[model samples]
Target: MKPADSAAVALLGLTVLGLAAPTAAAQVEPDPMVAGQRVRISDGRRCAQDGAARVSSRLFGPVVLRPGEGGMAAQARVAEGAAPGRYPVTIHCASGGASFTETVTVRDARVEGLNAAQAAGGLALLALAAGAAFWLRRTVGGRS
Candidate 1:
């Protein structure tokens, strides 16, 4: 093959590969978010420069996105009644008419509360405080 023709074929191959490459994906911070908590959505592709991008999820209704560092960002509150499970969140960019979906896991708010270990720690602290108080009373009262 002619050197020039080979160069053209190489360029075409690179072009095809570039076009087929996947774009950066959108992301939700604080994965395994608790119901009713606010979550930040970040668009890694910066596709919302036109200021018409939107994000939506079953757990949280449509949220209008605004330009943010690194890309676009938006905050949405998970419904208080959202069930504990994984839900798909989609970001639609009006500029390129491109949409990306990311899965977000919603956890029950109860999970945010103290667990068994924490409860045990609290109980231990309480008992120690009570014991200290009793000892102080016994020593001071006897001296009196």
Candidate 2:
């Protein structure tokens, strides 16, 4: 291929990769429970948040993470027919940055969803408050 053609192809390839990289990396379904909650975590290149203004790709692995790429956990991953152990996840993001991880003791254990525990606790509190309101209304009406 001609030099110009090769350059054009390379540019096209980079453009495609740029478009797809964010979709592939740091794409965790927004869990309201986890969002804005400061859980102990690490950052990586995949740390590019959804709808972020700037994103930086990174490597996730066992090593001290620093500012920039090749740093923290990008997203969750489980490969087919791969050996099991804690692997590093790296990420880099302009909007926000994070670096940390949880142990994958069992494969396919991490499912995305709201926390049942938090939801249940919130519901219980609401119930108790409702019961109290009913009791107060009854007492006030009887006194009047």
The per-prediction tally of clashing pairs is 0, 29
Best-matching candidate per TM-score: 1
Best by lDDT: 1
TM-score, candidate 1, is: 0.57
lDDT by residue for model 2 over 41-130, one digit each (tens)? 234244443423232222222223233344332232233433433333333344455433323221334435556777896786677556
Instruction: For model 2, state the Cα shift of residue 28 in Å.
Output: 14
Q: For candidate 1, lDDT tens digit of each residue in 26-124?
A: 788767688888888887765747676888778888798888666888888889888889999888887667888888778765445565667897787
lDDT of each: 0.76, 0.39
Candidate 2 error regions (>4 Å)? 1-60, 63-110
Model 1 misplaced stretches (Cα beyond 4 Å): 1-24, 46-48, 109-144
